[model samples]
Every structure is written in structure tokens, then in C-alpha cells.
Target chain A: LAKTTQPISMDSYEGQEVNITCSHNNIATNDYITWYQQFPSQGPRFIIQGYKTKVTNEVASLFIPADRKSSTLSLPRVSLSDTAVYYCLVFSGNTPLVFGKGTRLSVIA
Target chain B: DAMVIQNPRYQVTQFGKPVTLSCSQTLNHNVMYWYQQKSSQAPKLLFHYYDKDFNNEADTPDNFQSRRPNTSFCFLDIRSPGLGDAAMYLCATSRATGGYGYTFGSGTRLTVV
Candidate 1:
């Protein structure tokens, strides 16, 4: 399992775009980068995933550089409801995932 | 809405007493996982069931055990609860191995008194 590093916390205002970056320096060839959003007392929900390049969805966009050492999750028009912890996971095939301490994003209205 | 479900959103148990948390999923996924999350910490993998086969994490305490009688349902059993066992227990399911983000239940907050 590759260890991922993210900011401890972040602050953003409503209607603003918030981008949380994650670093996974030891990412492997078969490793896939995925992100999840977890609200207080709730399970983490899948946000977006990518092998390389950029992928966009209704909720967020994932951008991965060619090196694949890191990725970013971009949330558009943030709202107070979006305040939650965001996790970045690096998993190769058939391996159990290690959930690192994620970035806690607080959206202020 | 075929989703993951965890029962008794909150549970209170006395120290050294055994407690069980239930998880059921309508998605019928092949994999089920249990995670323990303490206050202000990341969710730690306790164990998971892959088609009736149980796998426990290396650091998971002996007190933590799991049973998967069949697909779509799994249980986390803490043999003897300690004060440190009080935390949120989360249940999730996925079709693939850790690549796809699994569906998570709201979690059961266990309080050991």
C-alpha cells in the first residue's frame, strides 16, 4: 500500500472553488487513485477516480499529472453542506486499502 | 435504493461486555469491510469478508472479530469492549478490490461505559 499525504485542514467560502491536493510519491504501475468524501458520522462516499489525466463528474473533477505521484479533487461552488473530510487512497490490484488521515475541508457560509 | 445499512446507529456497552454491530447491503457486492474510526482520526480497517472468507488486519486487536454468514450481510464482534473500544464502526461494500470507492453505512457509534 502506498502512503498518501494531504493537508490537515482547509477553509473555503461558499460558492468558491476548492481544490485539495494529495501526494502519493510511491504510487505503483497498477495503482489507481481514488477520492472519497466523508461527512460527520457518515461513511465515506466515492467522489471521483482516475488512472491518469483528468476526469470530470457532476460533483467533482480529478486531475492527475503524468507522473501519477499526486492528484487533486476540485469541488465547484462549495456550500456549507460540503464541509467534510476528504480521503485519498492509492490501491493496486487485490490489496486492502489503507485510509490515511484525510484533509478536513470546512466550508464557511 | 440498494444501499449499505447499519443498524442501531448508536450503541452503549459496559466495559468488558461483548457487542455486535450488524451490516447489510442490497447491492449484493462481493466484498464487505468493517472500519473503526476514533475521534479525529482516520478510519482504520479492522476486517473484511470476501465471499464468506474473513480477513483481519494485522494490527486489529484479538477482541475484534467478524462473521459473514452469507453474502450481503456481515457483522463485527468485539469480544470484550474496553474504554478504548468506544468509536464509530463503519460498514461498507464494493465490487472490486479497493479500486472502486465502496458504499458506506452511516456507522454505529459504540460507547463503552
Candidate 2:
């Protein structure tokens, strides 16, 4: 399992674009970068995942550099309901997930 | 919609008593996972079952045990509940490992008296 480092918390205003970056300096070649969002009193929900390059979905976009050592989650036009804790995880095939403290995003009106 | 279902959203157990938490899934996934999350803390993986094969985490306590009778049902048994055991237990299922498209239940909040 690879360790990830992200901000403890971040604050943004409504309609602003938010980018949360995660660094996994020792990421393995087989590992994939995944992101999850968790709200109050609920289980973590799958956000986006990518092995390399950029992957866009209906909810968010994942950008992975060529080095694969770091990735960024881009949330466009944030809203008050977007407030939640975001987790970045790195895992290979057939392995359990390891979660960190995660980055808490607070969206203010 | 296919989803993961957990029974008894809130559970209250007495100290030193044994309790079991049940999880069922309609997704028919091959892997099921149990996680314990305390207040203001990250969800910690306790163990998982990959089609009847059990995989327990290295740091998980001995008192925590799990049983997967079949593909649709899995159970978490706490032999001796203590005050520290009170937390939210989340059940999740995935088609396979690598954490792909995991569907998690609403979770069962356990309280120890």
C-alpha cells in the first residue's frame, strides 16, 4: 500500500473551482489513484479513479501526471452541498483500501 | 437499484456482551468488506471476504470476527463489547478488489452501554 498526503482542510466559496491535490511519492507501477467523497454520517462514495493521464466523469475530473507520483481532483462550480471529506487512495489489484485522515472541504455561500 | 443493505441502523449493546452485525448485498459482488469508523476519524478496514476466503487486517483485534455464510450475507461478531467498541460499522461490496465501484450501506451505528 502507498501512503498519500493531502491538505487537512480547505475552504472555498460557492461557484468557485476547487482543486485538491494528493501526493504519493512512492506510488507503485501497478497502483491506481482513486478518490472518494464522504458526507456527514454516511459511507464514502466513489468519486473518480485514474491510472494515468486525465479521466473525466459526470461528477469530477482526475488529472494524473506522467510521473504518477501525484494527482489532483478538480471540482467545478462548487456549491454548499459539496462540503465533505475527500480521500485519496492508492491500491493495486486484489488489495484492500487504505484511507488517510482526508481533506475536509468547506464550501461557504 | 442494486445496493448493499445493513440491518438495524442503530445497535445498543451492553458491555462484555456479544453482538453481531449483519450485512446483505443485492449487487452479488464477489468481495465484501467491514470497516470501523470512529467520530472524527477515518474508516478503518477490519476484514473482508472474497467469495468465502477471509482476509483480516494485520492490526485488527482478535475479538473482532467475521463470517460469510454465502455471497449475499456476511456477519460481524464482537465477542466482548467495551466502551471503546462503540462506533459506526460500515459494510461495503465491490465486484472485485482494487476498490472499484464499491457500494456501501448506510452503516450501523453501535453504542455500548
Candidate 3:
């Protein structure tokens, strides 16, 4: 397990793009960068994950640099419903994952 | 499809009383995990069971115990509920697919009164 650092909070207007970056300088070689979204009264949801380079899904995109020291979660065309606390975690292939304080994204209308 | 389901979304237990939280999953994942989250805080992993092998976190209190009777169901038992234990308990399941696409339940909100 590796410790991750992310912004405390971020705000964006609806239909805008929101980018939340996380830094894990001590990230292990086998560690993968993963992001999760947690809404009010609900469990954290898996948003996106990537080992290296860039990975895109229908929901979001995970961008990893060559160093893998940091990663960014890009949410396009944000909506009010997309507002939530986003977590960035680092974990090996088989181990219990840890959740950090995470960056809270507020998509305002 | 309700991949992961937790029973009694809201639970109220008296101080020092024992309570059990139940979780079931339809994904047929080999790994089941339990997490505790306080209000407006990040979730903390308490433990996980991978194919019936119980693995608890180093700092998790002994008061909190978990049992996995079968493949699809797991239980978290609190021997003595305290006010500090009031929070959301989330149950999540994942396969050994070498990814973090773990499916989580809605979570059980435990209120200690």
C-alpha cells in the first residue's frame, strides 16, 4: 500500500471539465492508480483505474504520467449529480486497499 | 442488478449491545471487504476475506469481528457497540481479475444510541 495526496476540495460549474490530481511519490512499482467516487449516503463507487499511460471509459478517464508519481482523473461535462468525494488510492495486485481523505468535487449548477 | 447488497440500511443499537451487519453479493466475487466510514470522512478498510481466508487490518479493534460462512454472504459482529462506532459500514466485493472494479453495496448506517 502507498500513501496518496489529493486536493482537499474543488469546485466547477456544470457542463465544465473537472480534473482532480493525486500524488503518490512513494508509489510501489507494482502499484496501480485507482480512483473512487463516493456520494452522500452511498458507498464509494469505482470511477476509473490505470496502471500507466491513459485509460478511458464511458464514465471518466485516468491519466498517468511516465513516472507514475501522480495521476489525474478527468471528468468531462460535469453535472450536479456528479458532485461527490473522489478518492485516489494505490494498491498492489493482491492486498487490502486504503482510502485517503480524497478531493471533494462540487459540480455547481 | 444489485451486485452487492447489505441488510438493514439503517441500524440502531444500544450502547454496549451486540449487533451484526449482514452483506451478500451476487457477483460471485472471491473477495469480500468491510469498510467503516465516519461522517464526511474517507472510508477505512477493516478487513477482507478472499475465498474464505480471513484477513484483518492491523489496527482494527478486536471488538469488531467478521465471519464468512459461505461464498456469497459475510457478517460483521460488534460485541459492544459504542457511540464512536456509529458510522456507515460498507460491503464490497471483487473478483481476482487483477483490477479494482470492486462493486460496493449501498452500506449500512449504524446509529448508536
Task: Score every model by TM-score.
Answer: 0.98, 0.99, 0.97
Residue ranges of candidate 2 with Cα displaced over 4 Å: none
CA lDDT of each prediction against the hidden true structure:
0.92, 0.95, 0.92
Q: Which runs in model 1 stand beyond 4 Å of their true positions?
A: none
Q: Tens digits of per-residue lDDT for model 1 on A1-109?
A: 7889999999999999999999999999999999999999898898998999999999999999999999999999999999999999999879866799999999998
Determine which window of 10 residues in candidate 2 chain B has minimal summed lDDT: B97-106
Error of 1 at B88 (Å): 0.2
Instruction: Show the colliding residue pairs in model 1.
Output: none
* Model 3, total clashes: 0
Candidate 1 residue-wise lDDT, B24-110, digit = tens: 999989999999999999999998888877888889999999999889789899999999999999998998666586889999999
Quote the RMSD, in angstroms, for model 1: 0.8
Better of 1 and 2 by TM-score: 2
Tell me which of candidates 1 and 2 scores higher on DockQ.
2
What clash count goes with each model?
0, 0, 0
Docking quality of model 2: it rates as high
Candidate 3's C-alpha runs over 4 A off are B97-99
Spell out the clash pairs found in candidate 3.
Answer: none
Candidate maximizing DockQ: 2
lDDT of residue A97 for candidate 3 = 70
